[model samples]
Target chain A: MYQTNQYEGMIAETVSMRGHNGDVINAYVARPLGAGPFPGMVVIHHAPGWDEWYRECARRFAHHGYVSISPNLYFRDGHGTPEDVGAKVRAAGGAPDARVLGDLDGANAWLRSLPYVSRKVGIFGTCSGGRQAFLAGCRLKGLDAVIECWGGRVVQSKEELTPNQPVAPIDYTKDLSCPIIGIFGNEDKSPTPEQVNAHEAELKKHGKQYEFHRYEGAGHGFFYYDRPAYRQEQAVDGWKKVLAFTEKTLR
Target chain B: MCTMIAHQVRIQGRGKSGPEWFEVHEANVSYDHPYDLPLEHALNIDFVNETLGPGARVAVELSVDAARQLVKTIEAVLAQADQRGVLEDRPVAAEPARSPSVA
Candidate 1:
């Protein structure tokens, strides 16, 4: 059981564990104000780390009756500011696939061990977080559902920030054990229509339960209302779709 | 100086022998930004009619630079389409995967 923070109504706690490469991992857990175990959701942050936006996202999930955990994927080096972490990520040529998959597994185990979390858990993310969600559904086990929004598909040999590689979701569609949904902007250059179409074809071939939403005239980051790329109508509609998907699958 | 302008172009007309109707739409134009400008400024009634439809609505928001670039791109595409006689003015059907209930 975890205790609430000084803010009140927000269940906040911390845990220290080991990640994929045996690096020490630190994570934050947030739950609803009420009692009883709730549905678990592993919320992966974008590449930089656990910023305020990421924490608020976890709180939002908690508000909706889920035990949300946001893990620090870059905890190996240290808990630095977002800018510092961004620099490190750039210096390291971005995160490697092996390390990311391992950290996701570690986060999953941590969520499962939480006393207030139910056995059925899901994963959700956006941008880099979305990529992690896809990896979790593909490489991890026992996930009930997964939601990925605007995740970049890097096509390169060494995991450089934006190398050309097969779309992540498409490449791993056959290995997914749970239903996965992806949202993209038609104008997002990172994952072009060709890439999205390939992913859809792969899902169709495997007969997997999946969904892909492409908003015409909307560019990357359309769901982020705070950003210049935000499209309010599209973002609202996307949120409705996400909530409905969660309620149908997570419930 | 850089300026951002938002515009709406409603095209109402009959499609060959079809019924007459008006399509309400909005476009955001930005200057100096290369990518979004072209897409935004290229957004005239015909472009909207071709991309959206004679009866459909569209909303576009972009920076000033992007608006100019958008107009240029749209004009280029339109010019080419005109020469080829493949300027499709019909509304495009929304892809199935974009639907919320798609399973």
Candidate 2:
């Protein structure tokens, strides 16, 4: 794994593509500079908006030899500071699930269309992004794998369901088209341990290829080194598993 | 975990977002992650004029205790103003003041 000199480089930039209803949307693309085709990864930003952290996340995937695509799901709302747009979107009761799915589908297509792509793609998401990742894995046809890290609201109670999210994501388990590995914190409130168990049961019932890793003494957003919830040991191990899963499944 | 819990109400207020002050037409409140706070989550408040754009916002993140205390304090001040007959619920000018740079 160690080489003193390996030809290494990457290109990261912003690009526009068609999203829902053929509307053009912005997305960040990061890819290694070599000529051979590379595996693809779609990085869906959390509810915090498509901020700097997610952009860096795309680059991190590129560094690991995956072509990463991160779309600004809130682009239709407005553009400003990430926090401002995030707050506005939250106030409006989160980005419409339909819209996010459409944007993600578009991003996946754009990534597959790239000349340097391997045609296999994995999706990575945290918080609400995680929920969308799982939803996409079920609703979209081409995703090869899913890394759903601490996604909440997948098992919504009838009361928790909103007009925008009329059905629970778990209800779509039968449609999951790819193997999925989940990263969850035991202490997470939204998807409590029980909800995680329920999600597992659904997968088991459907006989879907899936795995879940639960971390003790950690809560939501454990990989966000920028936040207080970051757990060094857990995040390190989790990253190893995520990269391994992507490699084994997509590469 | 993103609760996706938030509510916005129309309000008349002036808020200083960054260096300049602007007229705020809405107050959005929620319990969610904060942009500047160190904790996992907070009771967030946003004073904004959405028509002016996303930047027309002054945001605050407070702990649960702090948010409750703020609500009680606001009630107390309003009660005192009401008892003293000094409350000015209506604006002196029918038209609200506007900020040129903020707009």
> Candidate 1 DockQ category?
incorrect
Candidate 1 lDDT by residue in tens digits, A1-251: 23565333667777786678777788777887765477888888765346677777788888777888887876654334553443234323346667777877877777788776777788998866776687678878889999888765522123333331223445677798999888888987645667667767877899989988889878766765555678888888887787778877887
Q: What are the per-residue Cα lDDT tens digits for candidate 1 across B13-94?
A: 3222123333223222212112223231222221123233222222233555565787799999999999999998897543
- TM for every model, in the order presented, reads 0.64, 0.96
Give the Å shift of residue A27 in candidate 1: 1.5
**How many clashes (backbone N, Cα, C below 3 Å) per candidate?**
24, 0
lDDT of 2 by residue, A3-109 (tens): 66977899999999888777999999999998759999999999988899899999999999999999999998888878878888988889888988899899989
State the displacement of the C-alpha of residue B40, model 2, in Å, after optimal TM-score superposition: 2.1
Question: Fraction of the real A/B interface contacts present in each candidate?
Answer: 0.00, 0.75
- The residue ranges of model 1 lying beyond 4 angstroms of the native Cα positions read A1-8, A154-169, B1-103
